[model samples]
Target chain A: MKVIETINLSKIFEGVVPVHAVNQVNLSIEDNEFTAIVGPSGSGKTTLLNMIGGLDRPTSGTIKVNQIALNELSENELINFRLKHIGFVFQSYNLIPVLSAKENAEFVMLLQNIPAKDRIARVEALLKEVGLEDKMNNRPSQLSGGQQQRVAVARALASKPDFVLADEPTANLDSKSAENLLDIMHRLNKEEGITFVFSTHDQRVIDRARRVITLEDGKIISDVIQHEN
Target chain B: MIFKVAWRNIWRHKVRSTVVFIAIALGLWAGLFTSAFTHGMMNQKIDSVIKMEMSHFQIHKPGFREELQVKLLMNDGENIVQAIQEEKEVIGVSGRIVTMAMLGSANKNGSVRLNGINPDDESIVTGINEKLVEGEYFRGVERNPILISRKIAEKYKVKIKSKVVLTMQDMEGNIVAGAFKVVGLFDTQNGMYDELNVFVRRDDMARLLGVGNSLHEIAVLLGRHDMAESMADKYQHVYPKLEVLPWMDLSTGMRMMIEMMDTYTFIIVGIILVALLFSIVNTMLMAVLERVKEIGMLMSIGMSKTRVFMMIVVETICLTFLGAPLGILLSYGSISYFGTHGINLGDAAYADMGFSNVIYPSLEYMDYLVVSMMVIIMAVLAAIYPAIKALRLKPVEAIRKI
Candidate 1:
């Protein structure tokens, strides 16, 4: 079943002359599918990804995730839904600088008001899974780029979200770190059945995704499934 | 966990956090010092009034306090004392005689009020014996001895054992003339008390006034300091004709003026606090703006906007908590240092202020706590606008901030 479906999604930055960042688009992503949205700079891949993640509103359209319409939720309900159902990994490896690797992973769970014992155990297990158990106590500045990105991945998975959004997650990483991160993400997707959607221009990432969706000038050009379920 | 994270965040940006901490600390310190000094000054004034003049409570000839002349005593002075003695809260009660007299010395002269009191009873209200510098206090009611103030002594150059003549109208409307030996000089320090007041024994006053064993005013002391008001209320009901004036009423002008000074001090402090509050608000707002992308990232990771708001507020509270106490501590040290060796507003400046030899800025611990709490609260309040701004920020726009 489609875990996320976008119908005629569009976003226009209103001004003296409105700039159409994301034009009319329709796409569907299946559960547990590793999908990538690839485009050049200002090609609206990030904008399209934002709309799907419920991080933004479409000027007109419907985005359904797990069969619930994203556009229909109030500001408050959207926040609650996101905390429980959606996770994001960004290019900046945005692990809070002050928090340790483990703490960065555990933050979303804290917001969920999860009990401390469960939170601690989950964070520990995730850090180990990310191969950051030894560096769990290290803060963002103390960690290498790849290590920080791994923590970010661990954080994204900590909430047990049905879907994860990665926006240029490998942009700041070297080839080796990027490869290592993708392998870990792929493993998590296969083993845990967590869905992954990434917005990226990295060919290595595009070559690896089970599905690829291409966007240009704010509209999807193609939707191709390259790998079998 | 939020508090722990917030706390660590403060230390992460060492220099910036330190600056903020110092600002908060300074705000709190200044607030504490000002409040403490004001409170201390008030306490000092009240103590002086209670110590030197009004003995907690006083009974007077129904109208004698307003009209300054010795008059008929309370109809039942002994009975009143007996009644007061029955109340556990009554510390002590005394009979007092008050009359106006012309005071003269070889070099200077002034008109002064003479208070006739019992040596033993006066001791119950205030430390009169300690204030006596030159000579002994009156031995008994018949000694015809007087204790004049140090200022009066300085003007008269009258030594202990010197005889001085005083003239005043007695209660019966007769002008009584008498000579009394100056046994001691007291320096009460208060302007009104020091310059023109003398003390004589209650018996001699009764003799001079021709009131046989009757009292002009009954002064009662409370067992506890704070009970003066309630005690006075009881005294009022007990003796309708008698005026029950607490020490607060005795120095009304001084209290009012002190309160006025405190109000002015608060206004000045409040202005500074508001400025500090704005500085804090501006800093937080700037921080929120700079971290918009990060905030969006957090929200996208399934963290709510409410969580974002809480995190910002936690950071603010952490910063302020870190700073406020240090400021209060510094203020305490400064106030203490100045309190002992007063600020010395310069002798000329001190004189200009119409105060004594020194201007002491003193405070108590509770003053520090209260002020620190207030500054912290204001600092927290300052973060509200920024926190709400963070909550209102759309995740997409914030993440894509140019």
Candidate 2:
């Protein structure tokens, strides 16, 4: 089943001169799909991802996630929707600095009001799966760039989200750390069947994606699929 | 969890948090200390007035206070005094013959209110005997011996045993003059009262005024000052023909001063807290601004705006709680120490104000509780604007903030 579908999604930035950041973009991602939206600067890859995650409202379009129209929800309702269904990983590794890796992983489920026992069990398992079990007590500042990003992934998966939206998640990492992060995410995607839609400029990330959609000037230029190397 | 996060968040900037904590602590300490000191001064002044002049309550014939006419004297003054003395609450009572007269010395002359008293009974009521600075208190002196303040002695260039003349009209409307020797010079710490009043034997005063056994005022001292009003009310019922006045009625200025003291303290502390309020708001706003990206991340991870707001408030409250109790305890310790040891203003400064040089600072525990609560409330109020500012951030945009 399609987990996310966007029909004619458009966003316009009004300024001294109008800028069409995303124009009439139609996209669909299936469950457990490892999809990459690849583009150069000004190609609106982040804007498209923001729209799909309900982080930004579309200027004119309908984004349906699991049959719920994202544009029809109120601001507060959209926040709840994102909290329950769509997790996010930002380029900057935006982990709460004061929280340790384990606490950060448990944060989303805590907000969901899940039972403390289940929250702790799920967070422990997710941290172990992401190879961060031993580093669970270290705060983000104590962790390296790779470790912090891994904690972010564990946090995103803690809520059992339907899909995870990642915007340039590997852009700030060293090459090896980037490759390791991609391996962990790919493994989680394969083993847990957790779908992921990422916006990236990194060629290494595109190389690993199962499907790639290339955009230029806010329009899709190509859509292609690749088998395992 | 929000509390845990908030508590950890404040310590992230150790220097900044410590600075705010110390500022609040010092502000509260200063406010409490100032209040205690002011209360001490006012209390001393009030106590002096009640002890040396008004006592707790006084009784007089109707219209006597309005005009000091000898005809408006209590007809049964001894009976009223006996009744007051028999009351369980009454500690002391004094009957006085008061008359306006001109006091004349060899070098100076002034108009003064002459008070006639039984020296022994007056001593119990006003402690006048304890205030004698020279010679004896109307003891072993010749006929018509008198007590004069040191201010009056210095003004008249007279000393103990110097003879002075008093002239006044008798009750029969006849003008009379009498000569008296100054048996004692007293300093009441009240320059105005010292200059305006002279004490003479009630027998001598009555003989000169030709009104035998007539008393214009009956002063009553109570064991507990808090019972003054009720005692006054009871006295009025027992002696309906006479006017019974509590210290508050006899001295309106003192009453007004006491009433305004609490209001003044509140205004003063409120102004201090307002200054603190601005400082706290500025600091919390800076904290929120510095953590925009992290705040956005939390919101994006499903933290509600209300939760974010409460986190800021909790952080502020923790900061306040950290400082307020320390400040209050510090103030309490300091006030208690000084209350026992006393803070001495120079004698000359307090001389004219009817106050002693040494003032013992005091505060009720309720005042500490009130001031601490005010500081906490101010802190919460101060946090609101910053918390609302944190809530206004759009997660998408704030996550992009550098």
Candidate 3:
């Protein structure tokens, strides 16, 4: 089943010289795929990801997640849809600095108005899955770079979304932390059958993905599969 | 959960938030303190007017106040004083034979109101007996004893036991002369009243003027000063032949002065609250601006605009509330202490203006609640700009900001 589909998506930044941040891109992700979108600087990989994640409106296109068109939703309805369906992991690990790890993980579910008992149970399980069970009570400021990223991952998955869109998840982590993070995400992907998509320039992320889509400028140049990974 | 987030967010920058807290605290303190001080000063003047000059209210025959004619006396004035003293709200009452007389001393002479009163009865209405600086209250003299103010004594070059002659008109329109000895020197602290009046035994003045038991003025003091106007109106209805006036009406510009001072007090408080409102707005705006990326991230992850806007408002209100209670407590503590102990002006300047030098600051419990409600309203008003700023943020553009 296709979880996310974007048809002819384009984002234009208008000025004296117009910049097409993402131009005429058509993309689809299956329900349980581990995919990576890789490109160099100014390649529109993050822009494409933002449009697909419902974080930005397309200059011209339609985005369907779970068969509902994003363009049809109002601004407020889009926020509610994002709350229910999209799990976002930013490059900077944007966990609320004031909340403890468990609180941050359960925040989206709380926004969804999930009952306290179910929210706690699912948040705890997700934290443990991301190897953060011991650090559940710690704030983001108290956690290291890799540890914060793992908590972000737990937060994203805690909502039980169809897929997680991560933008440079390991960009700020050291090599060893990055490897540890990738290992955890790979395990979660394979074991729980959760779909994951990432936009990155990191070679390590590209090597580990089941499929890789490479972009040049604002257009995709290649979509290749590495089944062994 | 939103409240929890907002409360935690306030502490993220402890020094910034603490600065806001202290501003609210000190600003409210100053505002309330100044208001209480103004109230105290004005109330002191009111007490002086009621106690020393007018005695809450006064009564005279219809034409006597406008023209100090001896023939315009209240024939039933003594009966009226006794009747007023029987009222439940009446604390004291006194009747006097009031006439303008040429008071002549060996050294000088001046025109003054010769207030002829029964010394014992007058003492009940006005506490003049307690205000004597030298000599006694109508004592140390045998015949026709008189009480004079310090200003009168100084101007006449007279002292206690000095003989002065009063020349005044009788009810028969005859100019009569009588000799009186000063027995006491008193200072009412109201320079105008002090300079214009002298007191003598009512029997002495009436005897010399050839009148019996007839009086020109009846003064009545009430238990509560606020009831003066209504009681005066009631008495005016009951005694239609006489004119009754409250203390406010008896003094020139008294009503305007009270209203002006009240307006000035509110202006002082209003200025302080406006200043506090700006301080909160600026600080909360800074807080919102500093957290753009975080706010954008929260919205991107599905926090509604309403929720985000409310978060800023809640944070601002929480910050304001933190200081409001402290400010109120400080105000209550200081006002409570000073209300009894009094704040001395350290000079007789206030007294010369007919106000007490030592002022006891006070506020009703309701004023605090009203001021608190004002602060809460100010906090919410102060929150609007920053909260709206947060709501206007676009997640895409905002998340890109550092």
Candidate 4:
């Protein structure tokens, strides 16, 4: 089942000399699959992920996420769709530095207007699942890089989003911390059937992803599916 | 949760938040202090006028104020006084006779208005006992005593108990003369009042002017000075033919001057507030720039633009609401203490502003409340530009931001 599909998608920054960031590309992401898009700097991997996640508009193509034409939706409707269906994690572990681990995890549910009682339970359950229940009240600054990423993953899954989009999630982490965070994400994907498409350059993250796509200079060069060991 | 986030965000950059809080507090304190100072100065001036010239309320014949002569006397002063006395707010009422007269010494000379009042009644209206500089207020009207202003006494070389001659028109329209011993001296603290007013027993003038059956004007004091307007309204209704003037309307020129001062104050304060607003806006815009990635993360996590906008505004509102009122409270304390002790500007300094001696920076409670509201409003409005910038931010670019 295709959870995300892009047909001839491209992104160009209009200037005196128009710069093409993402060249025409077609891709499909399977439901509950862990996919990694890896490329060197300036390869347009982030832009392609952004288009698929409804965060950016493709210059000339259709992006169908769960069979819905995202480009056709109004701005407000797109916001609603993102809120209800998509989750996001960032390279910086963008866990709202102001909030504690628990609060950051519950942010999406709060945006969903979920009742406080249910929101609390879901937040606690996700925090426990991420093995950060002891750090529930600790802010991102207080948590280790690995713990913060775990919190970000818990936050992404809080509202039961159909899929999660992570942009270089382990780019700012140490080797050990990156391995710990990737292990948590892999366990979550297997146990909860949550689809994830991440953009990264780290070989460790690529090794953990079930499918890997390689890109160079804004164009995809290879797509390979690794059999589960 | 948004409020919680906003509250926590303020503490994240403790030094910056503290500086913003202090800036807002200082702005509020300055605004409230100035507002309170204006209120106090205006009130002190008004009270000085009430104590020196008009009491809380004054009544006259229909055309008496215009003519200000013996001919404009109210024939039924006793009856009107009786009717006005029925109101509980009326503290004291006095019937008076006033005439423009020439006052002179052996060498120097000046013109003044001679006001004749029932001595016992006049004391209640003007606090004559408190204002006496020398000699004493007359006990009864039959003795025909007069109180000369201190400035007039010094200029004319008139001593207490010295006889002075006053020349004025009689009720029959002929120039008349009357002699009276100076029984008391007073300083009303207003240069105009001290130079141009003479007080005497009412019967003396009534006999000299030959208007024994009438009175020039009626002055009434009320329980509270602020109740003057409502009491004047009642007086106007009761005696439609007469002019019922409150102390404020009686001194229209001075009130207008004070009001003009208020307008000038508003203009200056308005400029400062605008500058302060821009400062706050610039600060919040900087926060937006620094937190671009954070905002993008919030939006990507399904926070709507409206919610982001609200969160920013709510944070501003909370900061201002907390800080501004504290500043106002500080202002209130400073003004209240100084208002009573009165930092003296000295006679020469006071005279520069055309005031008599001292300036009291007084403030009413309402003034503080108004300034608090205004500062808060400025702060909330200041948040708009930054909030709109945050709201319209595209999540993709914001997340990609450095």
Candidate 5:
């Protein structure tokens, strides 16, 4: 089953001169598939990711997630839909600065109105899986860059969304921290069958993706699949 | 959880939060203290006027007050006094023969309103005996002895036992003149009243004016001045022929002063809170602007716009809650202490204003509650603009904000 399908997705930024940020992009993301949307600067990868996560409305497009038409929903309805079915990770490691790692992980489920006992159990399990169990009580500022990203991943999965959309999730980390983050994400994908769609130019992320789509000037240039992990 | 996050968020910028907290606390303290001081001054003025000038209520023949003529004396003075004293609320009563006359000494002459009283009854009604600053109150003095204020003595260059002559029209239209000695000098701390009034024996004044056993005014003191209006109404109903007036009617200027004190206090405090409202809005706006990205992150994670708005409002309210109670406590302690010890505004300053030098600050319990509630309300009003500002940020754009 496809988790998200976008047909003829386009976004135009109107200014002194119009710029087509995302043009006629067609994509289907299947359940439990780890994919990467890779591109150079100005290629509209972030714009595409934002649309898929319901963070932005398309100039003209139809987005169906779990067979529900995204374009037909109001802005408020789109927020509710995103809350129930989609999770996002930004490159800046945007963990709430005042919240501990455990609380940050539990935040999405809290918004979901999950029972406190179940929320605590799931948060503990996810933090342990991401190798942040011991650092659960530390605020975002007290954690390392890699640890914060791992907490972000745990937060994204806490809502039990159909897929997680990450925009350059490893761009701000050191090489070793970037590698550790990728390993954690890969392990979670393999063990838990959680799907991920990331927008990145990082070679380390590209090397680890099972399928990669490359874009240039808002158009897909190549679509390739790797047989090796 | 939203409250917990908001509470922690305020402390993240300790200096900013502390600045707002201190501003609110100090603003409330200043407003309450100033209001209490104003209430104190008004209370002092009211008490002075009631005690030395107009006892709670006064009764008079209808035309006497308008004309100040000796002929307008009450026909049955003894019966009116007996009726007033029978009222359950009345604590003291006195009858007086009041007439406008000119007082002359060897060196100077001045116009005065002379009040003739039986010294013992007058003491119970106005406590005039206690205000005597020199010589004896009409006690142990010979016939035609009088009491004049120290202001009168200084102006006329007269002293105790100095002989002064009073000149007035008799009830039969004769211009009568009588010689009297100044037996006592009284200072009532009311410069205007002191300079205009002189107290003499009622018997002596009646004899000189040739109106035997007749009186112009009956003053009644009540157990509580707050009961004055009701008592005055009752007296007016019973003595329809006589004019019954409460202190508020007898002195319109002082009554207006008391009423204006309440209104002006509210207006002044309202202005202060409005100024505080702007300051609070500015601070909270800065907090919201600085946390744009974080706010975006929360909204993207499905914290509803309503929740986001409430978080900011709750944060502002929490800040006020932290500061207001402390301000109230501090103001209460200071007002209580000063109320007992009294704030002396110097003799000259008070004398010029026709009040006593010492003022005791006062506040009702409700004032503290009202002021604190006003601060909280101002904080809530202050939060609205900032909260709406937070809601206007689109997640995509806000997440991109540096």
Candidate 6:
């Protein structure tokens, strides 16, 4: 089941010399697929991921998530679509510093107007799965870098998005923390059939991904399937 | 959830937020207290003017006050006074033989407005008897007794039982002079009023000026200050030939002073609020700038612009309210304390300028509410610039920033 598809997607940042950040990229992401969009510096992995998640307006081309053309949506509609369908995990842990771990985890569900009881139940389960149940009441400042990332993960998944987008989620973590985060995500992808698309330079993330899509100078150079469940 | 985030966000920088809170509180306290002081001073001036100089309103035959024409006297002064005294609002009425004259002592000569009145009626109308510092209102000297202000006495080198000659034109336009002994010295605390006025017995003045029983001025004191204008209007209509004026109209400068002071009070409060507004704007802008990455994350996760804006506004308002209550309590406490105990501005300059030296700071309940409303409005306005700054954040770019 195709959850995301991009047809001839391109983005040009106009300047003294216009830079084509993402050019003529065609991609498809299916449900339960653990894919990594891999590239070096100045490559278009992050730009492509942003367009697919409805976070940026494409200069040209149409991005369809669940068959809804993202380019056709207004700014407000795009935000609503992202809230309902997509989750984001950033390179730096972006958990609200003022909120507790549980509060941060429940933030998305709260935005979705979910019932308090259901939200509490789901958030608790997600935090426990991320192994932060013990630290639920702790603020981000009180948590380790890896623990904060885990809270971010729980928070992204709280609204039960159709797919989660991870943009170098383990870039700032240590080797052990990175390995732990990848394993947790891999387990969720397999057991719950959750889809994830990561944009990363991290070899560890690429090694764990079931499919690797490589890009150079904003164009796809290679796509290789590692293993399928 | 947005409110929760906003509330917690304010306390994130405890020291900064506290500073902003204190700034707002102190600003409000200063503004309100200053307004109270102004109000107290003006109220005192108004009370003194109504009670001593101009008794709510006064009446005179048309053209009598402007020219001091002795012949243009109100021939039916006694009837007019009797009729006005019948009104329920009327507290006291006095028909006066008023004329501008020269009061000459042996050593010096001074210009004065001679108020010739029945001693009892004059005392009731202007409370002049209570202001006497020495001697009596109408007694001590048998043949001709006159009351002089301390300013007049000091200037003319006269005292109780000292004889003074008043010279003025009679109804026939002939210059007539009479010697009257100063029986009392009164101090009205109004320098200008005390300097220019002297009182003599109406019968003595009438005999000296040969005006028979005609009165040049009729002063009426009303129980309530607010009733002065309507009663003046009523009397003006009843006696169309007479020029009736309320205390506010007797001297247009007095009216202007009252209005100008009220305006100045609000302006002073407004200036303080505006200064505080800038401080709040700067503080909230810093708060927004500090959380660029976090705010971007919230937006990237689908928080609407309105919610983002409201979050900032609520945070700013929450911060302001922290100080607002403290400021209001401070203002209230100080106003109450100073109002009762009085703030004696140890300066005779105020008395010399026709105001009491001691001020009792006051504010109407409505004015307090108005000041609070102004503060709330200021807080909201202050939040706008910073909230807009937050709303302008683009998640794509802002996330890229550290």
Q: Give candidate 4 regions above 4 Å deviation.
A: A115-121, A128-131, B56-89, B139-144, B169-179, B206-214, B222-249, B254-275, B335-345, B348-369
**Predicted complex 6: DockQ:** 0.82
lDDT of 6 at B301: 90
Docking outcome class, model 4? medium
The C-alpha RMSD in Å for every predicted model, in order, reads 4.2, 2.0, 2.3, 3.4, 1.9, 1.5
- Give the higher-lDDT candidate: 2 or 5: 2
For model 5, residues B1-402, the per-residue Cα lDDT tens digits are: 888898998898899888887887788888998899999988888888888778899999887787898888887897888877888888889999998899999889889999999888889888989999999998656889999999999999999989999999899988999999988999988777889999999989989988888789998899997999998998899889888999999887887887788889888898889988998899889989999999998888778888899999999898777778878888899999999998887766566576777778899998888887788789899999999999999999989888
Kindly report the interface RMSD of candidate 2, rounded to 1 decimal.
0.9
Better of 1 and 4 by TM-score: 4
- Position B75, candidate 3: lDDT: 86
Q: Each prediction's TM-score against the native?
A: 0.85, 0.95, 0.94, 0.88, 0.96, 0.97
- Ordering by TM-score: 6, 5, 2, 3, 4, 1
Clashes of each: 2, 0, 0, 1, 0, 0
TM-score of chain B of 4: 0.86
Regions more than 4 Å wrong, model 6: none
In candidate 5, what are the lDDT values of residues A1-229, reduced to their tens digit? 9998999999999999998988998888888878999999999999888888888988998888998888888878887888889888899989999999999999889888999999999999999998998999999999999999999999999999999999999999999999998998888788888899999999999999999988887877888887444
* Rank by lDDT (best first): 6, 3, 2, 5, 4, 1
Q: Write the per-residue lDDT of candidate 4 for residues B1-402, one digit (tens) a residue.
A: 889887876676778877877877787777766766666666766776776678887888766777686788889987887787777877788888888987766666667898988777777778776788998877433366889888889989998887788888997889988878888898877667777889887778888898885887888888898899988987798788888988888776877978887997687678768877887788788878789989987887778888999899987777666677677778778887887787665666444343656667876667666676788789789889999999878888787788
Stronger candidate by TM-score (2 vs 4): 2
Tens digits of per-residue lDDT for model 6 on B174-284? 999999999999988777788889999999999988888889988899999999999999989999988999999886678999889989987989899999999999999
Docking class of 3: high
Alpha-carbon shift of residue B368 in model 2 (angstroms): 1.4
Which DockQ value does candidate 2 get? 0.75
Candidate 2, pairs of clashing residues: none
Off by over 4 Å in 1: A113-133, A186-194, A225-229, B22-36, B71-91, B139-144, B170-177, B202-214, B254-283, B323-380
Report the CA-based lDDT of candidate 3 relative to the real structure: 0.91
Give model 3's DockQ, 2 decimals: 0.83
Please state the interface RMSD for every predicted structure, separated by commas: 1.5, 0.9, 0.6, 0.9, 0.8, 0.7
Backbone collision tally, model 3 = 0
**Model 3 pairs in collision:** none
- Residue-level lDDT of model 2, residues B49-76, one tens digit each, is 7788899999998888877888777767
